[model samples]
Target: MRRGAGIGAIRNREMVQAKYKEKGAEMAETQMATLSRQLAQLRTSLESFAAKHGTKIKNDPEFRGQFQAMCSSIGVDPIAYSRGCWSEALGLGEFYYHLGVRIIEVCMTNQKRTGGILPLNELVAQLNATKSSYASEISTDDVQRSIKKLRCLGTGFMLIHLAGGRTLVQSVPGEMSMDKTSVLGLAETHSGQTTMSLCCQEFGWSEDRARTALNQLVQEGMSWVDDADPTGERVYWFPSLFQAVRSSG
Candidate 1:
């Protein structure tokens, strides 16, 4: 009787273990399915964004190369990166479309010169007219948000004050041009090394300041540092900086 009871208990334990194993497998499968769906949604969004922008973002070499490098470093597929670029371009295109419509209206009404550029006041009036048509769409708040987004993507406009009370809004080209010195400093400090703190100590900067500058450079595509240091130190380098150094010599 004792042996029979013991055998029954052993079989019950085995059954419980098998049930737990099946549940674990089901959970893993469900998680994978969820991830797959999310990725699909992201891809769709990216493609839609690109489609809205026309061909400018798709064909821009500098933009494409920087985007590809960043995406590759972070393990994003090349196709996905292309889609993201398109999406970003589409957003900018929408703003430009509105602006272009206003410009055409202003040019037709005020200026007899077809090819010659108009003055700053005329441009501002056109922009204002455009803003008025889509007042709900082009509020001050929206402009601020758009500017922030553009800055993140390394594109922005600067208001330059010219002679005789004129202001011109010009596009700032290339991330490197805007932040060259700081980017070079970061690349120099982190080249072939990791851990901004160690670099900071070697270069006589506070750890916090060094980290901030280094992170900014990394975001701007001038340098890169690994997130993890299982090997006891971080590593950093800038491919562009290396090329520049080689070319100069």
Candidate 2:
């Protein structure tokens, strides 16, 4: 009788555990179904909203920027016209394609001058100065999106969010060295100019360490050497600061 009772108890415990496992599996399946319905609803709502505001999204840079942000929040790339279905519904393929070509042209045409790392302001300024097929005015947000699309193609386009409101666009493919990057950051504080002493003073780097970066920039046409500083310390000016200086002037 004792043996029979023990076996019955073990069987009851197994039955309870089996029921719990079945309940958990059913709950998981129901939750997944609910999530799928929510996602489908979200996609439909986005499509409807985009259809209503299609003109503003295509013609106005600021409006387009906001629209892109909305799409991004939901992990949607409606502006990527190269991808099939979104391109047809939004009709923004030509606009982004034109803007992307223009960006590439601007970066390539001026690479010799700015070493392919352009200030976002300068890029926007240049983009607006010309007549683009799709846009009358280009915003930083638009430029950034276009760059993001270009980057997906495995190109070298990159955005650098610098301190303050300044942004940099690197058009080339190579990864910038840490030393060179630090030097550029330091130049941002001193009206786009820095020297070995300033770099050393700010970063506590040795003279040799400073020159290695500054000299490479100078050689790459990114920085212009000015031996005429009144303090007698050689100054390296970043061409990347052109738009900011011009706007202030």
TM-score of each: 0.31, 0.84
For candidate 1, write residues 42-135 as lDDT tens digits.
Answer: 6665456446634544344345445444444545544323345454554444554454445446544532321212334445544556555524
Winning candidate number (lDDT): 2
Scored by CA lDDT, what does every candidate get?
Answer: 0.48, 0.81
Model 1 spans > 4 angstroms off: 59-62, 69-249
Clashing pairs in 2: none
What tens digits encode model 2's per-residue C-alpha lDDT throughout 25-76?
9999999999889887987787887778777777788888887777778777
Q: Which stretches of candidate 2 lie over 4 Å from their true place?
A: 1-11, 81-85, 132-136, 227-232
Residue 9 of model 1, lDDT score: 96
Give the range of the ten consecutive residues with the poorest summed lDDT in model 1: 110-119
